[model samples]
Target: MMKDLQNKTIGVFFGGQNPEHEISIITGEFVIAELRKMGLKVIAVYIDKNGIWYSNKKISELKFFQKDYAKKLENLSSCYLDLTLSRNKLVLHCNKFLSRKKIDIDFVFPTFHGLYGEDGTIQGLTEFFHVPYAGCGVYASSVSIDKGLTKKLLSSLNIPTTDFIISYRHEFTSNDDSLIFKIKRKLTFPVFVKPARAGSSIGITKVKNADELKVALALAFHYDTKIIVENSVENIVDLTCAVLSDGSKIVTSDVQESVFGSSDLFDYSMKYLEDGGAQTGNAESNLIIPANISNKHTEKIKEYSKHIFKEIDASGTIRVDFLLNKKTGELYANEINTLPGTLYHHLWEKTGYQINEVLEKMLLQGYARWRESKEIHKDFKTDVLNNANQLKLQHHSE
Candidate 1:
């Protein structure tokens, strides 16, 4: 027990300057909603697209986000990024309101996705502030969000993944034909190219031939500087397995497959708010709960997901994606979402854990991590402050 966090203010942080800002809101609101249901005092921290922060009672409502809604937020309290050891507590920069109104966060649940939000910058702030928060620590969040880093780490661990290659903007700018030829030679046609540091299918493209590779690269490069090209999994079922960790052990969720629309390639729209208007099939997109896959495949995915979670030193929960080619039965682990969509509670809900229980579990995990850090000894006997004069004298003598 962290002693201070019991029934204290739990901040559900969401939104950022990333393209996934709206989706982040959806995820953040889910967490906030669940926390409220759990009887926890929750604070909704909204980071505007321009990086401005806000935490107000009205933020709890979903429609506060309608385009002309900026005016509605006029009454909401504004927050600023101090970039110091003060992430948990947002200081009221406005003097008049500073005295009476202050938001002190006892805990943080960062539901922000992509770029600065989930890329370890916010996690670093929480670490500096020494506050309990849910999701992976700084290091894990950093590696997991970076595609190149994740592939390297997973490859080093001897995990099976799709064949791929990286291309630098400089190389592409040079109009390197070898890049295309090399990709075609090593991997078959129908390649998957994505921005190395992006999420939510923002910059993912499936190319049918060498001609489309260039266009895909250009599109993906618009989102990220680095390019990760992988072999497309034809006739494959894309699955996501969410794993939760509490240090002692990690638990796995039943494998859930993504059922895309008519477009063989699942793009941004198919990902978030499926445009097919097929709500019935969406039920299939959800977790199968004790997935219908063979025990061998389930075990393999579960073990792989757990290993990736541990290899990344991931805390809280992480959703690891995988592609299993139906024809060949070849399994390749895809990217890991450090701050997975909606905390992936839907998958866990099948295990008798309600949204409230999920919130509590995540909170407990966050506090446990914070408490573990406190257990580490960092005291020093020497008085460096008092010895400043002696140090100056020694430097002068030297």
Candidate 2:
């Protein structure tokens, strides 16, 4: 399968009109490098924060974005996807007159982390073009991005998850007291307030008391319209496991426990800015693989990770987070990241697979899913359109 892909061109899409744009760029470059190592033709498709698409070979290099990168935009060509069903190509428009180039893309590998790109938007675009793409499909992407929706689905399936209450910006604005009352009635203090649709630990606040609740909600609302307030688990240990699938079988990676700082919170700084910043893939030492837990807990986490992946109809690779309560020895599903940072290759690496191997499996699974979708009868013979004139006449009579 890897050999078959070698001859095909894959578009590695990253960066977007998202808060996690910088992180996405890192993941994108990592993917491009690994794909090239496999002898695959790769195109770096970069979407700026303004939502403008650009293409340049230089984008494959991390240094190309540093030191006044905005000025470098002129060096890159503006590009857009030619979503015509028959032609899955990326159209690059150069600065020169009548200068347009089209690059045929056999597959799309999305390294986007949050919002516009990861929350079903980019996936939907590829689906419209009938193009095979990596990561979860529209349904899975949309559900997994919203923390509130994910918890609701998990609860429905009897999957244990932390208790959470959702608050909309409009509701909070209209009746702050009522919303606060509802939150206080349902959840206890020291709750974690988070932007429901945001990631990278951005716009998250660990509210310690009633006095801090309002401030936390405001911060969360600044990032997203909906906010989720989850009860903070006492003596919590943050554990994450990665899951990969080829549309037939599911595999779980070794569970890793994230060591937190004095704040006891895994915020944005802890995730991307701890070590040498986002450039160095964060601090490796902060993540302890084969987490310091019993065999039973590890197996349970692995089981839950696989179950969540399958239940959500997810494809490709994903990272599932769980909050372990050391005091009570209880585990609760925190959230699911359909497109985890750097595809959570670190966890998979510890699980006996290289980054290239993981990417290969994702691309193959995407192709398989696309092929299966094509088999479904989309052009069903129907008389509804044929009776248009009769239907119009009946409507006029009415």
| Candidate 2 positional error at 263, Å | 1.5
For candidate 1, report its TM-score: 0.87
Candidate 1 per-residue C-alpha lDDT over 1-398 given as tens digits, one digit per residue, 9 for 90 to 100: 53456568888889898888988888888788877876778888888888887877778867778566678767666766454536545343422354545557778889999988899988888877787888788999888888888888879989998878887787777865877787888888788889998887888888988888888988888888888998888877878788886667688888876666457665666666654211112344532556566778888999999988888888878889888887788888988998877776667776555666566667778888888888888897888788679777889999
Off by over 4 Å in 1: 2-4, 74-77, 81-100, 176-178, 275-290, 379-398
Per-residue lDDT value at 297 in model 2: 93
Worst 10 residues of 1 by lDDT: 275-284
- Stretches off by above 4 angstroms in model 2 are 83-98, 277-282, 389-398
TM-score of each: 0.87, 0.94
Model 2 lDDT tens row, 1-398: 55667687888999999799999998999889888888889989899999888877888898998778889986667876554523453444434357776666778899998999899998998887777888899999999999999999989888899889988999889998888889899999879999999998899998888888888889999999999999999898999988998877789999998887566588788788878443233677777888999899999999988989989999999889999998899999999999888888877888899887788789989888887888888777788877679777889999
- lDDT for model 1, on a 0 to 1 scale? 0.78
